[model samples]
Target: MEKKQRMSRRSEQMGDQIEERIVTGVYPPGMRLDETELASGFGVSRTPVREALIQLASAGLVEIRPRRGAIVAEIGQHRLYEMFEVMAELEAMCGRLAARRITESEQRALVAAHQACEAARDANDPDAYYQRNERFHHLIYAASHNVFLEEQAAALHRRLRPYRRLQLRVRDRMGTSFSEHAGIVEAILAQDGELAATRIRTHVVVQGQRFADLIASLPMLGSPSLT
Candidate 1:
């Protein structure tokens, strides 16, 4: 059981790494993902690599064809926008519920996550900030005290992870994001459900200049390569 659990955790980590590479254009859209190569690259057995690819497929970040094996999935801008739209609403709901239902311990945890994000921002490290930012948002989801809603929010969060990380690379976005997070944390901690919902929704929804910036920064799609 312990060995199985360890493999599962490794596969999850592999999935996250592969998804990052895909989003960052290391594994461009349409690139064939060879299990053996990936296994070697990640220093694992083919079993975990296959498992990772399968998980990515389930998240719609990878497509597994009958004979073609696995290939990176290309998400068009419009489709991505739609996904973010839904994500914003889902997160808003979480914020609203969290404000109403969060326990004292959860509130402390949320603050800690926010502080971690602040450290990452102060250091001007987008990669570190991105990871901490995920934890911050996830704490809100868990604090909502709704298992089903938490599950839905988490699933969509995974699907949008790459784009969200890319957005952080925009100039001064880390500072802006941290400021927005400040508002969100304040409202939630104050137990203001409506205010928390509004703040979180505004923070999440990419609009106008932000949308343009994200699209402009997207890694250029290229021909598939078996890397």
Candidate 2:
């Protein structure tokens, strides 16, 4: 079990590095990732590197071809918008359910998570805020007290993590995201399901605008690697 956990952590770290490169356009679209090269660069064995690529493929960040190895996934504009749309609805549902079903303990946990996000935001750390942002949403999903719903939310959240992380790179996005969290938390705490739903839906969907800012700021948008 310990060995498995270690391997899992290593794979996750490798995936994070590769995902960062892709998001920042260092790797760009259609950049074929050689497992051996990545392993050597990261000072790891190919085993973990291969595992990481597989994980990335599942997250929609990479595509694995029979003879081509792994390359970044070329997600189209329409598909990207569709994904954000679904993500908004999922988050809104979580918030709505959490507002009506959250226990006192869960509420406290949510507050703590929000506070952590605030700390991360105030420190001007996008990476830290991203981590806390995850915790904040996870707490709400847990508050929903529906195992299936939480699982669904988690799966999609994992798939969208890279895109969401990129949006945080937009100018002053962390501050705005933090402010949005304030409204979301307030609505949930007040047991206003309708308000929570609306606030969270808007908050998630706002990433679309952030994506636009990111594209505009960058020299060029990366192309998708079609398998």
Candidate 3:
């Protein structure tokens, strides 16, 4: 690959690593991003780090201030709630469509994802469960067959990743999430469009609530200043 392609690939990989850290709450929200520090951390140059920041900014995952610096995006309760509202509608639509359009292969994939989550939960592995849970949701999104809805829901999911991970950080949450997913799969399997829609919406709304609860009990989440 040419130097340009190499840089692009490196920037993309660095961006994915940074985004994963952000979503996993390792970076947390509202934290300042020092380009030099990030560059050193990744054994790269400031250019790639800057490029990654720009990519994250475009995704609403970070904010680049004019001279202040780049920082993880701060989110308010209202904004979080708004995201849930929009996401719930999108996921509800996906569930309704999926109930009507899901294929046998998709169903089996969903089931396997669910089983993986259950196994992770049984092992008391929050991190592993979160990964499988994401795969399970993505399977449903794909099964819906609405490209626009899939894209929209995926964007929302990306934004909510850190918060969702926080909720799962609570003790026994893996089990709870696994149960919720199981019910969601059952609703989809029965071809109960309305039921699936309602359940999926409630599932997401509950996520928002769980996030709020996590912040309330921990307080570390909402207190991170974008400095």
Off by over 4 Å in 2: 207-209, 217-227
Writing each residue's lDDT as its tens digit, candidate 1 over 1-227 gives 99999999999999889987887778988899999999998889999899999999988889999999999887777777778899999999999999999999999999999999999999999999999999999999999999999999999998888789989999999999999999999999999999999999999989889988987777633332311
Quality of model 3 by C-alpha lDDT: 0.81
lDDT of 2 by residue, 51-108 (tens): 9999999888899998999987676655666677888898899999999999999989
Per-residue error for 152 in candidate 2, Å, reads: 1.9
TM-score-based ranking:
2, 1, 3
Model 2 has how many clashing residue pairs?
Answer: 1
- Residue pairs of candidate 3 with colliding backbone atoms: none
Q: Which stretches of candidate 3 lie over 4 Å from their true place?
A: 1-31, 67-69, 207-211, 217-227
Q: By TM-score, how accurate is candidate 2? A: 0.92
**The 10-residue segment with the lowest total lDDT in model 3:** 218-227
The TM-score measured for candidate 3 stands at 0.81
Tens digit per residue, CA lDDT, model 3, 1-227: 69999999988888878887876567867789999999998898999899988988877778899887998876555666667678888888999999999999999998999999999898888778778888988888999998988988888887776567667878777777777788899999999999999988887775455755756643323433322
Candidate 1 vs candidate 3, TM-score winner: 1
Q: Which candidate should be chosen as best, given TM-score against the real structure?
A: 2
Cα misplacement distance, residue 186 of candidate 1 (Å): 0.8
